[model samples]
Target: MDQLEFAYPWAFILLPLPVLVYWFVPAYRSREDAIKVPFFTEILRALNETPKVAAGLLSPKHWQRGMLILSWMLIVSALAKPSILGEVQTREDFGRDVLMLVDLSGSMDEADFTTADGSTLTRLNAAKNVLKTFIAKRSGDRFGLILFGDAAFIQTPFTADQQVWLSLLEEAQTGMAGQSTHLGDAIGLGIKVFEQNPQPSEQQVMIVLTDGNDTGSFVEPVDAAKIAAARGIKIYTIAMGDPTHVGEQPMDMEVVQRVSQLTQARAFIAIDQAELDKAYQLIDKLEPQQYSSASFRPKITLHYYLIAIVLALHLLIFSWMTLRQMFSRAEVANE
Candidate 1:
């Protein structure tokens, strides 16, 4: 509102057009200039002492012509399209791009974890429930899903639609990717996915939930974590399984901890459902909400005011002409 501007500033070229026309065009010429004076006496001069041409030049019509010119200027100014712009206000957006790397290996099918309802659920099911809540809390953030076992693959691409992401997460089944856990390959694949689009390091996050150590991977887990750190991608690793008893898939705490430390993140050992929930809660705290601001200024058109001024001047000219005509008719009737 403080500054005035034209949407189409080039239209200002028409502003001087009326002035140019008046300067370049010739004045009107009359076919006849005088009336015959047959008598050639002082009586004809006494009838009209003032010269008609000189009298016409001094008439009030000159004032009307000046008003017409002013009206034209207002019309041209309106056509130029003027507007007022307000101060820019910044809108802050708080969100982060999260890529979830989940283990869908055969061991995740273990129903050792129980829910708060005392009902039994598979490790994968418990993970799904916890993740559902976690993602729900991240309202404005974008999310992606990656499932890995013997081979790592992207289950869902990055998306902001929570419903769609949750649906995809629910669709996952154990051993869909493979029977063995390729923890390193999953991390590498996640890094590759993040690199494809690529955001600031602070804005990018990868959460890995696995029940076992790496069985076979083209890249080593620690090496992949180093790459993630160099690229500014934070990695939070959660080892979900009992570390005590030996099983088909044993949880590796050392590798997970190193991955987290290298990326300036925390490593969690989730033995049961409660521990896993707590781990996710800690991650939620560790990664604070990110805020980004964008500035924008609103604009309003002011051409209507100029148009109204032009209209008012023309109406005044018309009203004055009508009143003069009415007065002349009344004089003629009296005569």
Candidate 2:
């Protein structure tokens, strides 16, 4: 039980006031009525023979009086509405470590993007749209971001603070991390970030988004994927852009698939904004790991309602008794 509102319980001191009133107040009694008869001896005999009706009706037994008093006290106490409070606890399940690896290489600048509304957009703009929504939906999960081109670096550390991560993402731009894709280095750096966090039994996640093949990196893509697999990291790859366009080379889907197979993850080819959106939506369906802490104040209260009902019942009883006494007196006066 918990108290939703009251701050001080000392207000209950007023409860005793009603008890004191009930204890001191005198009970109602009717005035004595006198009767005269011609045969004094016979009248006295008759009076002795008659049952003591007034004593039985007007003055109840001691136990009955006690019951009335007890009933009143109970009613008053109920009005006080005492409350008891306690704490409640709950646990959440969340287990996947997520790293968003974005390719900021020069090739990502290709204008092959179109919004869901049919408006033309840049690849960077389209990626941001999908990524922001994805981040927002992952509550209670630890996440990080990696941006790579000529070099790879951790843009944000693994954290549960989605707002801060999204803010850093908004500031991310092409060439800010350099203008050539280092796919292996990006994956390797993502692994390093995840390594810093505590490892759970479930697999960690690496989502790599790239438009071009690996052009700059000391590490090989296959070797990076092997390292990630050995560490139980699942890699989901997204290859962006239309391969059929002139001067646009098709991304190495076989290499991407090989990496996915090695790391026990999936690979996706997003030729346009719509495909990218669908790919991300699929990832969103996969739940993330969560951790949480809660604080509580407990209380219990039901006295007020009980008291109200009791008081109303007793008031009705008292009114009926008073009316009966008045009618009896009126009948005697008429006789």
Instruction: Highest TM-score: give the candidate number.
Output: 1
TM-score of candidate 1 relative to the true fold: 0.67
lDDT of 1 by residue, 130-192 (tens): 999899777767889999988999988888789999999999999899898888899999988
Candidate 1 clashing pairs, residues 3+ apart or interchain: 1-85, 1-86
Residue-by-residue lDDT tens digits, candidate 2, 42-155:
866867875243622367689667657667666555545566665664454455568899988777777878776888876777888898888777786767899988898888
Q: Candidate 1 deviates by what RMSD?
A: 9.1
* C-alpha TM-score for every candidate: 0.67, 0.58
Candidate 1 lowest-lDDT run of ten: 51-60
Candidate 2 minimal-lDDT segment of 10 residues: 49-58
